[model samples]
Target: MDALANAPDILSATAENTRHREWRLPRRAVSWLQVLPLTAILVVLFALPTLLFLVVSFFDYDRTGIYPAFLLDSYREIFTSASTLRVYGSTLKFAAIVWAITLFLGFNIAYFLIFHVRNPKIRIIFFLLCAIPFFTSAIIRTMAWIPFLGRSGVFNQAVMGLGFTSQPLSFLLFSDFSVVIAYVHLYTLLMIGPIANSLSKIDRSLVEAARDAGASRWQIMAHVIIPLSKTGIALGSILVITQVMGDYFVVRQMSGGQSASIVSALSVEIQAMQYPPAAANAIVLVVIVALMVGCLLRIVDVRKELMK
Candidate 1:
């Protein structure tokens, strides 16, 4: 009789405990529902197209951009040929050099913004200075580099006026160096944002504590700041590297097809109606970028940092 009487109360308590656990688990799941539309859009838009492109990359294309059923010839050609190898090497080199430069410059700028600029309004202003360039059309920005670096451009004029050289520098307008410079200018903002966001979250007191403990500036930066900023650095590097790797407009506009990055080569293939080769090149680029990003993620807890 006693057990029967206590049964309803015990059951009610168990139900309440379960409900409490459910509530305490997390509210994040609810937020994730908002991403469903984005996920659906990506699937319908990007994923489908990417899959189709991958499928077409193995086939042969005619002058009309029509693909016929074929074998692995495109991939084989891209892999086995020395010309294709050189394109890949050049693309990798450009991306690497741009990544390194952007990483260094972006980190320094972001650090200065977060640590040196104490005023919120002023900090925001400085950030806006970096961001405003993006509001302009990217194509326009690329074109803008031309007048500054062309034979009759501002850069050449300035140098000639300074008597730095007897002749206009031909190297500035249509070379790999120009492409890299333009890429750095275009992508530096991306690098700065992640790094600044990361650096801003770090507790200022940690730096102070290190200094109080007689740690030198370099030691504090190396041990405390750099480790904490690893996530930002990784993210920045990924952004710069990916942008540089897949870039087309800047390379084309600045180099005028005189130089061949992977992107420029892909553009040429596309223009020549060689869809299969272009698709193959794109797939290779995507794979390379994916591998690079995966490697970077290994060093930094990107997920955790992004969530925070």
Candidate 2:
């Protein structure tokens, strides 16, 4: 009986000692000071600029790039104009085509890298090749395409030399075809990176097991690999869609300012000091990108798949 009574006292005393120790111990914590600089940078560079643009979208621009304190006129012009609507439709169509092409091509390249290439050194070399374009300036890369696709360029010379055509193809340059081609070349690396990262995480044994279970190569790819690669597809689609939607430089260069994409049109307004209309166009682009990202999030739980 005495021992039982003393047991509660001993337990209470131990609990009290634990409390005292916890109170006395200095808490080792990660310092927020380290994060503050990055946080401040994000606020200044991204958050503030985005907020300012949003506010400017609601104002009215005059000849001096200054906007009258107002709302609705810029947005009204965006929606009410038939030309703007046509441009919006064209932009959406272009974005869809780019997304589909990037997804298909990116998946194939990533699958080849992960499954076909067993040699690590060769794989690294190939990946570096994809990444090397990014090291050069985007302007220079776009400019390089001009000479190759121009009337007297190498492509035209090759065609002429082969006796395929007597005259250079006028459709090859300063058109939507050129724009799409440039986009595919420039953004292929972006698509490849995410797909490769996702493919790297998949277990090779699962594929082997599927094959051993009397599954054909096609069946294994369709049933096993593709389902497992949904995250990569989703990520690549989002990246391609967002990039193509907002891209100005490549489209402007390839189209030779003869045609206008949404971004290119918006740039024109900005250059003319039509800040309000430019801001309005920017907001429209943001909304479109947000909708695409939201759809992707709904389709795939990227965080969960990434964790796996």
Candidate 3:
């Protein structure tokens, strides 16, 4: 009689457990379904191309074109080539310089926009002004620098007229300086946009609390703001470095064939129909950039920021 009485309670508990599992299963399915499209897109677009290049990187190739045989000659040649070191050295130099300059400019501009600006309408107007240059084509923007920096150009003429120098600066065009200038003009926006987003998301009350505790403005910025904005800084660094490293035309045009880079080397190989070597070179660059991005992610939880 007791067993019969307790049977209903036991069955009720079982039903509750079953209902809990049933509820969880759909939630799990829905979560996965939400990410499915993005996963599919990544697989189709990025993963497949990377896999294909990785495969081709190991294949044998010659003047006769690619063959089915596996070989390491491409990578071996790339590592052994004398020009390879110089190209990468130049590329890395450009990347380091550009990254530093952009980070400094981007961080300060973002700080000003986020912390100092009080009026929403004025802030929007300032942001629009920053973004206005970006609406133009990159090619046009890049070429525009040529005329502006040339001998007897507007900038040179102004400087000379103002008695800043007797002659137009030769280093202003077709040199490393020119390349860096163009890169800063174009890529500073990439850094500013990300850093501004990060700064905007930071809690303003934290800054007020820090000031209340006897911290100066600089102190508050150094301790409170920088810690939270590291993710944006890292992201901006990645974008600037990668873009500088992959540039073929800007360096080419600005340096007047004096500087060479990994992309330029890759372009040379591609034009010469050296498929395996080009693929190997590309894969190596991809690996380097991936390592950099991975290191940055280890320092900051960008995933959490994105989730928020």
* Backbone clashes in model 1, listed as residue pairs: none
Question: If the candidates were sorted by their TM-score against the true structure, best first, what order would they fall in?
Answer: 3, 1, 2
Could you give candidate 2's per-residue lDDT for residues 1-308 as a string of tens digits?
99965755565555556765673332221124335567899999999999899999998667866655868888989999988888888778878888778888898999899889999999999999888988998778878878898889889989999999999987888888888888888787778888888888889899889989999999998999888888888888888888888887777788877667798889889888889889988998898889889999889999898887
Better of 1 and 3 by TM-score: 3
What global local distance difference test value does model 2 have? Answer: 0.83
lDDT score, candidate 1, position 81: 92
What are the RMSDs of all candidates, in order? 8.6, 9.9, 9.1
User: lDDT of all predictions, in order shown?
Assistant: 0.86, 0.83, 0.87
Worst 10 residues of 3 by lDDT: 7-16
Model 2 vs. true fold: TM = 0.85
**lDDT value, residue 42 of candidate 3:** 100
Pairs clashing within candidate 2: none
Candidate 1 least-lDDT 10 residues: 24-33
Residues 26-78 of candidate 1: C-alpha lDDT, one tens digit per residue: 33443344456678999999999999989998887666656557678788889
- In TM-score terms, candidate 3 sits at 0.90
TM-score of each: 0.86, 0.85, 0.90
Clashing residue pairs in candidate 3 (N, C-alpha, C atoms within 3 angstroms): none
Q: After superposition, which runs of candidate 1 have C-alpha atoms over 4 Å from their true positions?
A: 1-33, 61-70
Preferred candidate (TM-score higher): 2 or 3: 3
